[model samples]
Target: MTETIIPGTYIDVRAEGLISAGRIATGVLGIVGTASNGPVGQPVTLALPSQARTRFGLADDPRNPTDGANPLTLVRAVELAYANGASTVVAVRVAGTGKTSASYTLRNDSGQQIAALTTRVPGSWGNAVEVSLQDSEEDCLVERENVESPFNGVRYAPVVPSPRTRVRVVRGATGQAEGFDVVYRRLQSEEQVRPTAAGRFFLDATPVEAGVPAARISVRKPGGVLVDYTGDAIVYETGVPAAGTVRIDPASGELTFAAEEVPAAGAQVTATYGVGHALPTTGQVLLTTWSGDLDFADGEAPVQGDTVEVTYLLDRDSCVQVTLTNAGTVERFVGPDADFLSARINAASQLVSAEPDDLLGNQRPVNDEGLMGSGSNVHGADGANAGRDEYAAGLAALENQLVNIVVLAGQHATTHGDVLAAHLALTANSEHERIGVIGAAGSSVEDINAHGMADGRVVVVAPGIRYPDGITLASGHTAAAVAGLVASVSPQTSLTNKPLNIPDVDQDFNRGQQAQLIGGNVLTIVRKGGFRVLRGVTSEGEGMPYSAIPTRRIVDYARYGVRSAADPYIGRLNNVRVRDALKSSLDGFLTRMVDEEALTGYELDVFADRSQEIRGEVSVVMTLQPTFSIEFVLVTMFLR
Candidate 1:
């Protein structure tokens, strides 16, 4: 028998209409028919219905019965139908008695029922044979070069192409057909591969209709580990050959890969880099103890001539005391470098006469210069020139004697006589009596006596003389000369006409006045003395004999004579010195006393010291007390 083979189906089948047309009569007909023959040269066309024929070994309708329906062949048929672009196919059914019918149901690869059919029915002249074939491609070998099976990394394989088979191609190595072009073309025409700017790959290169990028293929390892691609181009080496899965999407920069536990926790990471800028700073200046003549360095120089006050912590309880030594040395006339003798004289005069009392007293008498007189003398010759020359001579003699008297008075008062007495007598004689002579020329007793006798006789002989002879003679004569003259002049008496009765009344009056004046002047002098006397006496006379004088007689005398002196010189001097000394001493004493007492508020005390001393120059000490005994209280009440 001749047979036909179909690609992707059955291999061979019997020819149609080859069976006898008549049925055998039991046994006789069966044997006779077996020997009977038809025309030997005629081709007998076998007749069969289309429903009974199977195309590609499949029934026209899948509902038709075949040899129990081969499920494997059916499944193969569905796969080939899909691959061959057929919508549907039919399976052929065979009946009993060697007859067949084609009524198989049609179906697509999805098993959905379909209507496409190839059916046939055999004639009843004799029994017939039928065959079913699937409309599927044969299971033939399809060889490919470098065709990668999606499941494994095999390089070459002869595969039966199926609808579900996923394949890819690379370069071919041998005669096996390369499917790379076909795969590439299919991929290009249907789905494309693209690279994204993020260096990722995507299956569909075309942009989405909504203007979004194509979707990418991504794959993650266990625990969601992925492979990331930074925008920069990077090369990675596989130290060992690896056949692992990776997912990537070129259009979206999405990549996924598995990492082998990450070496340690944070491996395969990136670090960000940057730098920081420093801020500008203003300069500063530093100083040291001895930076030169200036307090700071030259770069930090101070303003010109600026005064800088610095403080030091001293062990002492108070600040150092500063005193001006010999401040009086600046005096224009009697300064430090002046002639010592001259300075001494001037100082003495200052001590005696510069008192507030003396300066404020009555004016000196007018002299020939038309100025107040200092009681210095003018002279002329006297004796042996009576009337015509005697007046001139006697006046000269009186002037000469007057000079001696002043000299005697100064010398006796400063040296031999009491200073108080000399001062008073000189004051009285000069201010009141108006003695004009200050020094004498004659030294001999006889010359002085002659001078005095001539002047004294003139006073008695010419009582009408405008200037008295006695005053003139005594004014200038030296004390020695006067004493000598007084001694030489004697009362020459023969039986002495009873001693002349000298009245004690006038003597007493004069003596009392002299004493009063001396006492008053002494008080004035003591009071006017400066701190020099006080400090000097205090320091030097610590155990001396006369230290009490300043506190006693001197103070009493000043207080008593404050109103008694008619001239008010003593009173003025007393008031000024007492006031000044009292203020100073009191200030010091009270400050200390108050500080010690620790009392508060406005309390006050006044004090004075009155004690006698025979020798010391200081005659008084005085003080005033503070109102507040507490320093803080005083500071708050008055100082503030």
Candidate 2:
């Protein structure tokens, strides 16, 4: 009997001299032997089946067994089977016992030996089926649900193997579908997906226009609530309206408006335009009055009644001349020149004249004829015409002609000399004439003493006579030496040969001869005869002496005292001490007097220079004597 074994098993045995063991194996091997020998003359000519053919019978040959066959031989038989269009050979079993051993060549279905098999009893075999691991087709749309809790309110999609689909997620929800569709079909078909994150996916969206927004924008307040009614326009809000038209400037992001006229308060008024536009208020029109008061607002409509009252004081010195124009609908007028002084109601009326009563009240009129009665000494017997008719008429004519006549009197005397002469002429002639005489005080006194010997027509008046100590004559005799001298002398009296009983006349005479007289002449004589002489009688008896005897030393001294009293005896002196003391004292007094007089005299000269109405040379001459007079008659007639 023969026993069959499965394929794919390896068996080993010691092939000793054991005929029975061989015989039993030969029965099983008879099938293998006959199948192996039928195809070839070799000991085992049958084709070996594959492991798969041994387990599951071959579809082409079912009787063949794969056990106890060489795997290399089976591999060759499989190659031949494949070439012959057969799948595989059938299984052929092998059986053996004890010390007997049998060997079978394993082959593939093509009859090529692939493995060797040796077996005794107690060996096992089985079939092996080949299987291939292949990659499965993937669907890109497949997605796993995300179950993890999201952070905050944002919901993140679950991670996938590839970025094939755009997954949408609710802000805070998880797992539940948000109804957002994903176009995964395109990803799966094209096999392409953007590698950017989900949040940044919008970066790949279509680009928008230069200034336009790709998405709708909503502006809200701080609370995230929308404000209502505001339009899309970029508006600028300010407390005051702009003065003129508003325009946008593209270059600078600032609002601009037209500039208005300057205001009266000198305020810096500004105008505003829309946002992102510059202020264009710079070249605006300014409306102002002649006096320069103005006000303006930009961007607002101007009305006929929208006027700014400008208060201005016209400065005529300014080069720009402004004509007063009545811009108001009603006519207006102004004063004196019609434009400056008239009211609106009196537009066509002429400006009224300024009456004398308007300014001067009921005073005397300034008319030429009316002025005749206002002067001193009018004409006619009545007081109204106090002998000034012809005079007044002549004066009026002279004044009307504005003639500047400089009258030169008969003589150029600064005192009352020429004036006294003129007065005498007028008195003698008794005619009505206008005359002015000017002369020095010295000349006036001289004239008075000469012509006015009996009458007291000339009066001396000192303007600013001062003393050595700067005391004015008005301060009385105690204050000034000149004032004291004036108080001692009688008014209008002759000062020549006036008895001045100097107690020290002898001493003075002696000193006067010792020094050469500096200011005036000195006379000295020697008397030779000596006698007692009565008034116009010479005595020879006891009542009188024999004859008059004259002394050898006789002196007479006098001085004009022009600038100084010591001038006469300043150089000649027996005793230098007495001479120097007297000279110094006298010189000091003379210097003070000269300074005061010179200053006052200079002031008087200035006054005379300014007196244009008074013609002729005016001078003020001073003398040491209190009384002053002129000896003109003595010079003219008595000079022989």
- Residue 315 Cα positional deviation in candidate 1, in Å, after optimal superposition: 99
**RMSD to truth, every model:** 75.2, 74.5
How well does candidate 1 score on lDDT at residue 188? 16
Residue 310's C-alpha lDDT in candidate 2? 16
TM-score for each candidate, following the candidate numbering: 0.13, 0.14
Candidate 1 has a TM-score of 0.13
Tens-place lDDT digits, model 2, residues 103-126: 232222343433222221111210
Superpose all Cα atoms of candidate 1 onto the true structure and report the RMSD in Å to 1 decimal. Answer: 75.2
In model 2, the worst 10-residue window by lDDT is: 549-558
C-alpha lDDT values of all predictions = 0.21, 0.21
